[model samples]
Target: MTKQITDDLAQALWETLLLHSTKGRLRYGDITAIACEFGLTTKAVTRVWKKGIRSMGDRVAAVVKAGWSRRGRKKSLQSQTRPRTTEDLIEESVMLEIMKCGGSNTYKIPHQHKDKLRNAGKLPTTLPCDVQA
Candidate 1:
């Protein structure tokens, strides 16, 4: 069974991250140390750290999917990050269909402007990333 990241733990982690943030960002070294202090993987802690920063940058609430899934035989970082709902899947499909019709559009998906995507209904209002690039 995969360990679940409870709201309380996530909240605590967020607060801890906030305290350690320098100009709204923490160094990766700091992230590793925080993870050690919290008895969590560095990736997990970093996931939370980046998300909080991104949310603030976007002027929205900080949110992330911070738990693992049980279906997978092995627990990998990718699986830990992608926890999707039916509605999310539907939205993604719609977005792909729209993108297919986007003639000569070659924007990198990850780096694309989210507001434009959201305005075009290609992405959801709230985007929770596992890691901030």
Candidate 2:
């Protein structure tokens, strides 16, 4: 995997490239000059510059600029604000009932039930009894 670039450096290079392009179209030589001025190799600068330009073109620069600071905050807030659906509630209740039915202690049950379930094709693809209790 490629190493990540710092936001400050990326932003600076993005602005620099944009300025260059606005005044006159940027070329490989311009990129090389900027890389030299920034004490970075041409390839490294090109990688960052291209990434920044792509991010800008796709209109995701602002979100990337913000990093993961607001990562799960909006999701949590939205979840708290919205009411759970009836289906969600029912599914949760069913899950709770399954948990209370000694689902985790299946090893205590006789092997006959497992064999019957397997024979009748009622068991899931993977047998729960094969897993830890």
Candidate 3:
């Protein structure tokens, strides 16, 4: 009568089978030899081979389904860097205009003059006096 293969024997033989299969040199005789060496039935050896094949198939299927490895933390909004917007550009130009105006008290400049500077891309959104620099 044939003996049942132990877990350790199955694992060892499965690893050996993987090595041989990768080399394209696996055969039924190889399994039979392993079974004989480990005192297991040929059926037991084949069962382990089937289990290994199934495990590999499951892994391949999972990766194929996801299209990539879905591991680790996802990207955060804080980590994302967006391109400068039109509003940001306008604000920067306004600040540059204020600096170019001799750094004098912005409150002293008339609203119409400030508006002209703003149209010329030389005014900040708010005067330095209006808000703390």
Top candidate, metric lDDT: 1
Model 3 poorest 10 in a row by lDDT: 60-69
lDDT of each: 0.66, 0.57, 0.59
TM-score of each: 0.44, 0.39, 0.38
Compared with the true structure, what per-residue lDDT tens digits does model 2 show for residues 54-110? 676787743224243445645456555534333443444445545656565433322
What is the C-alpha lDDT profile of model 1 across 1-133, one tens digit per residue?
1245766787789989888888886766888788778888877777777777888789998765455544468756985663444355455555554465564455343444555655576866444433221
* Residue-level lDDT tens digits of model 3 in 8-80: 5566777777766754346758888877777778777677777777767677421112112355777769547
Better of 2 and 3 by TM-score: 2
Error of 1 at 72 (Å): 8.8
How much is the lDDT of residue 63 in candidate 3? 14
Candidate 3 lDDT at 116 equals 64
Clashing pairs in 2: none
